[model samples]
Target: MNRRGFLMTASAAAAGFALAQAPGAAFAAPVRKALPRLKTQQVGSGDINFGYHSAGPEEGRPVVLLHDFGYDIHSFTEVIPLLAEQGFRVLVPYMRGHGSTRFKDKSIARSAQPEALGADTLTVIDSLHHPEAVVAGFGQGAVAARAFAQLKPTRCKGIVAVDGLWRPVPERAALQKDRRGFARKLWTANSPDWRFDEAVFARAAVSFDNPDFAAILTDTPSNAAVPTVSAPVLTLRGSASGIPVDDPTARMIEGAGHNLPLEAPQAFADAIAEMVRNAKWRT
Candidate 1:
């Protein structure tokens, strides 16, 4: 099985073990928390019904936070509240092929190249009724953010990215033994727990099912199109994540790894808050 498949198996095992410890666990439904200002919403974009989590006041400055591969909106569970409390309208969308977002045209492959994602993002921006907004993202989501800034320069005020630079897929000799091994290595490398987070991979199962995105995602160019981006950009990386500091805009988290947002949520928030302040954006 591929890494995504294996991780789901592992996560199921873990959840099963927890259930075995408590009889009737299977029968008990999960308790939903009373998360004020936190809601999952949908917007009708052409050819897609996008599902996303919305937070903060309706009239606040809008900021769209996109999650990395294998993560849904929940990846921003901690960060969303932080941004929302800071008086920003935050939207964490389940990217195409992730969570509840789905493509309406059955014939279209679920392509996730930045170009496609950029268009979708702009559609969401229009749906939100915002003239323009800040686009911040992680991993593959960063690709989407940068793409949006590049593709729709007028629709973005600034950008915040964490360790999402895409390099050309290394030569086979420099990579894992095979496709599954390579994928697993990466999936765990950037993960918050240093392993596939059960919830994360489970949420990404649908994304993995789409074979159309593999080439664009796996064979990224070394200079993954950051230079053409017009808006102000702030790139952050964990000290441990080997993402190269090619761009002068890049910064490092003192002691962290790929999932820098989770490792240093406040610092991440502060960087974004500072970027908003620097750009003089008004909510």
Candidate 2:
């Protein structure tokens, strides 16, 4: 079957969800307190210390959520609770060089190359003792998700790629000049439909302060050889993005841009839930 056949054009209705909260609305204190608190933890993997946030029942089916470049785990803030409530074990890891994740050895290369990021996903899953998981991500996180699927197909029940899957190109020299400005520009350019305030942007932007952020952002040879994915895949794109609609699976998310998790949390979470329900591994 064609790979594009995996694409399911998701909407709130089709995914069995309703947009109860206003877009970008802050959750009420009582509602927030009602949800399971995200447990922050770290695991030593290779030369990197991987930090991740997890929630939901311990025995719940595992689902790993990866955030895009220029953003951190908070990118999935809205989506996390939605999935957790549905009894999915949600794990959101800070990619290497982001958040509390750091290189253990000072001399170790700080590279966010797709292969390295993909390997980290597997490590996070293994460290957490999950047999397998539904891997989903946005932007560069999408790339990592795809890579993980290729690397260890059996471990990934399915993958939901939001916006687009991007291949990184090293531009460290130029990016180094104005990292924050670069990220700000990405937010404006990628999600033209979403009007995020300074506070929202600041929440994720602070992650760029990691010492190795620049190296990882700009470090690359663009030469991670990955095998063809044998696992089921779902591809989603924002109506506002430049991603082509040629593929059969290319479903455009109305009113969303490249940042689907933040701009359209309900739809994003719904996609993952859909994948979980349909996954062959689900017991």
Candidate 3:
């Protein structure tokens, strides 16, 4: 056979082999099973019943997702299917104090320490029976992912942080001054209709009740621990207004600051697909 013909045959053979090994193809070969709907699953040290939503085959490669505070798993609604379409099983859990995840004892305060959240995540993984899985987080969710990866380096297959606001979040006392400044800026930026009750803002702020949350927000600007993650870390930051500077991983995106899934879901989904593919390649 001519050299060119031989090369073409080899390439075709390789492609065929790859297709058979692919999760999508593998599932197609077998009898199809019904995929489950979004449901509550009890996981982690807190034994919290977390609301989980997923796409793609359960037997496919696992990619665990965590979302920012004040947002539910729905924050990732736009990105999960893309990952699944790429042949990855996406797992998103409601973090402690958010959505369906509640403290074991409602009376006991849930501390937002990286270690605590990390431990809880580990517990969830154990409960799910996945020996190893990729972990990714968005916004404040990135902090929990970083902590989880740091604590369970062996178990964490890969890590991705998107538009993390790890920068200094001012304490309430310090925020007093900024509040006035922000109020003045708001006054100039919009009409009186924009004015909202201070009580509404206060309730929103209290959700991040743990002292560590405040400490990290305030110190995140200089904090580099997030980049120290031993697992492959993919950091993404949006470019538009309100993008925070505290992202710890390598910044990978721009043009849609802060709210990546909302402002630019396609870009966000692509970033996650790349991270999962790269992570699988590395492993």
Candidate 4:
């Protein structure tokens, strides 16, 4: 079997083992703290129902959270509360195609390009009624975050990227082996615990079902239409155990990756708080 198949089989077996130990022993769900109330607003002309969970004073400085592809805003489960506790307004939302937010017109191309997403972000920000805010994104969301800053630099105070900055796909010689091998390794590299449900895995498989999906995701970054963003870029890469090593791009942004926000949420929070305090944001 391919690597992904093998890993899923392994994960299923491990999960079974943990379950046998105790219900709670199975891959522990993200902390079960009460979720902040969700607020719905219409952003952009398309009637896209933007959803945001906010915490902290309404008048406090704002920080926006953008998630990765095939991921809902909940990816920030570990980080949002901490930001709110630090006295910043946190807004986490479902991007256009995911969750309850549907495209205003089905005819519109659901292009997942950075520019398209960046525009969607502006609509969401405008709907929030916030004059300006800091934006942070993880994985593919970082692409949109950078685009947003490029498109509306005045509206963005700062940006923090966790596991952001995707390198262009390597040549075939660099792909390790065949497609199956690469897919499995790619999935495992990004998520070691592999806690996704079979249904979720199935959905991800569809995303890759298209012959072009892999190229689209892996190719876009190197050539992503990165707008001229003046906002200070802070990126967080995974450690040796995390994302596949790519050091050159990591150095461009004044940030750290690997065990950054994942292993150290508090440190990440502190760094963001400091960035807000120190940066002379145009927004």
Best by TM-score: 2
lDDT of 1 by residue, 1-283 (tens): 1110001111211222232233232223344433333357788658777888888877777888887654456667678889889888787887776556767877765665567777778888788777778888777677788888888787678888875555444433322223333334454444323433344434444444433224334333344454367788888777755344344556877777555666678878887787766664433
lDDT of each: 0.61, 0.69, 0.52, 0.54
Q: Order candidates by lDDT, high to low.
A: 2, 1, 4, 3
Write the residue-wise lDDT of candidate 3 on 176-202 in tens digits: 334333222222121111222333223
Model 1: residues >4 Å from true position, as ranges? Answer: 1-39, 168-184, 191-223, 242-248, 280-283
Q: How many backbone clashes does candidate 3 have?
A: 5
- Candidate 2 backbone overlaps, count: 0
In model 4, where is the ten-residue run with the lowest total lDDT? 1-10
Give me the runs in candidate 4 sitting further than 4 Å from their true place.
1-47, 166-187, 193-227, 245-263, 281-283
In model 4, state the lDDT of residue 13: 18
Of 1 and 2, the candidate ahead on TM-score is 2
Prediction 1 global C-alpha lDDT = 0.61
Pairs clashing within candidate 1: none
Model 2 error, position 25 (Å): 20
Model 1 residue 123 CA deviation in Å? 1.1
**1-283: candidate 2 lDDT, tens digit per residue:** 1110111111111111122222332211122112222457888657788888988878788889988777788878899899999998889998776788888888887876667777999989777778789999876677788778877888789988874334434334545786666565555545545677666766677677888887775564333343368788788787875332344576667888767887889998888999998888734
Q: Which 10 residues in a row give candidate 2 its minimum summed lDDT?
A: 1-10
